[model samples]
Target: MGHRHKNKKLGILIFLVVCVLFLHYCTIHDVVLRHAIYRMLFFLPLVLGSFWFGLKGAIFVSISIIIPYIPYVYHQWNGFYQEFDKFLEAGLFVFMGCLLGYLSEKQQREQEARLKAERLAAIGSAVSQIAHDLKSPLMAIGGFTKQVTRHLSIDHPDRKKLDLVISETFRMEAMVKEMLDFGRPFQLQKTEENLNHLAAECIEISLPFAKSSGVDINTEFDPEITVRPLDSNRMKQVILNLLTNAIQASSSGKIVSVRTKREKQGVALDISDCGCGIKAEDQQKIFEPFFSSKKEGTGLGLAIVKKIVELHGGHIILFSNPEGGVTFSIKLP
Candidate 1:
């Protein structure tokens, strides 16, 4: 897709350059009129560049036009008045490019943002309906399976199978809950709370999972950090999601670390793991809904984490650790 777009741009650029060359070299009895038409024609490429590629592209196209135009202007120079007019025309090309480029870029950004919001809304609605429909049936199945398991002897062959069924049912129920959460709007109940304490609590909650995964979790909390306004429950969800992911990503005996410290903006929380890092291309898409790299992942975990963080007027950043694995950092303001 990118290559196709580039090719189209290149084709248009070549066509525009051809027009300019033809105008410069073509024979004409009316030289003054021809020059006027040639100057006006320059606006086509400038306008296209502004709309197609924004400010830098417009500037680049304007500069490119000037290169071919300089020699023509020198050849057509009649006197001081004509030369000055030509230079003024060139100046206007640049000024127009900048103006059009800025407006075009702003419009493009607004359009993209609107489109994204619409897409997410559609996805959320569909997912909510599906999850709601499945909720009752899933509960019934899990409940009945548990009843069946209770009737079986502890060492019965079917008991183990029923236990697996129950585990899977619980996992599906969690995914459904995630869907509902993503579908609904966030209502933050903010209060002053210590970020360091929050991180510690989340770490403690994740301890069992970390231990099961044979991953050690370490923490560092800065004493200078103070309490800040946050929705404690939602923030805990974010931290726990990230911690769980880190634990899952690490191998046996690997370490996952959580850190909190004072920052100029507010406070920073970091979660790092010693597992295989994400591929470069996939990193940008990780926070996007339903974009997990895991085989059995519902892919809503990080998306929910990002949404909660953003609701608190904070942003999350991700990067690969130099040694191994990925680090997720959240900055609260």
Candidate 2:
């Protein structure tokens, strides 16, 4: 990357030098040739720079093209008509540079976004197939293990092995489900639901896991929350995934705080955990599917949460620091 940047900068410098030489030649030639060539040659660098290096480069080259013309205009101070014509030409050069540069940059961005969307769509299709193929066999294995475990007493020698098989199989099934969820379109069943009540319910459901991990859950909710239309089940899934992550990230004796508030325009939910905090690089890709920092993570939890939030016309904000921990804030309209 550094080599490419250096090469690009060198190319721009060479182009600037070439523009200066052209302007000098025009100034020293006949007035007719000077005016004709200036009208044509000066614009080449402006358009080229704009197309290559965008707005800043285009503006710089435009200024460089204009500076050399100043002395030429003063040297041949013919009349007001001549001077005005020269100034107008300069203005047109700058205008074209800015306009073309901006349009070129915008078009490039739009193209990049389109390509990214296409790639993600392809990935989703592939994941859907793979997850579907694995689900049926996984369910069968889990079912057989469960039946065998039920037949054996808890104290039987083989019961523990069967129980482990069942446990691992369920974990695998959950992972597969998450993959399917990620690869499918997020559909919400919306209803008018109490935000506070749903949050409390999820917290209670996670209590056993929190106790086993020796983490305490602290919650602060606004008393005057207005019931709003949302998908209660999907929202609960978001809460569960985040809470599970927080608890798993933190060590024993750490505290996880879940907070809810009624914003002026919408409702806000935040979950904070006192973990070691996410690394700088990891934070950027936290919501990207299949990008997980955890050894056992499938990397679809936060991705699915983000999809569900967007499906409901909401947004999520995240903050993290080693000293202060990580907080995920979800806002809904």
Instruction: Please name the candidate that would achieve the greatest lDDT relative to the true structure.
Output: 1
Model 1 C-alpha lDDT per residue in residues 1-333, reported as the tens digit of each score: 298997798579658966876776684635778767777887888888888888977988888888776676677668987578667877888999999999999999999999999999999999899999999999999999998988999999899889999999999999999999998888999999999989899988999998989999988889999888999999999998999889999999999999988888989999999989999999999999999999986788899999999899899999999999999999999
The models' CA-based lDDT, in order, is 0.89, 0.85
TM-score of 1: 0.88
Per-residue lDDT tens digits for candidate 2, residues 191-245, read: 9998999999999999999999999999999999989999999999999999999
Lowest lDDT 10-mer window, candidate 2? 20-29
Q: Whose TM-score is greatest here?
A: 1
| Pairs of residues at least 3 apart in sequence or in different chains that clash in candidate 1 | none
> For model 1, what is the C-alpha lDDT against the true structure?
0.89
Show pairs that collide, candidate 2. none
Let me know the TM-score candidate 2 reaches against the reference structure: 0.82
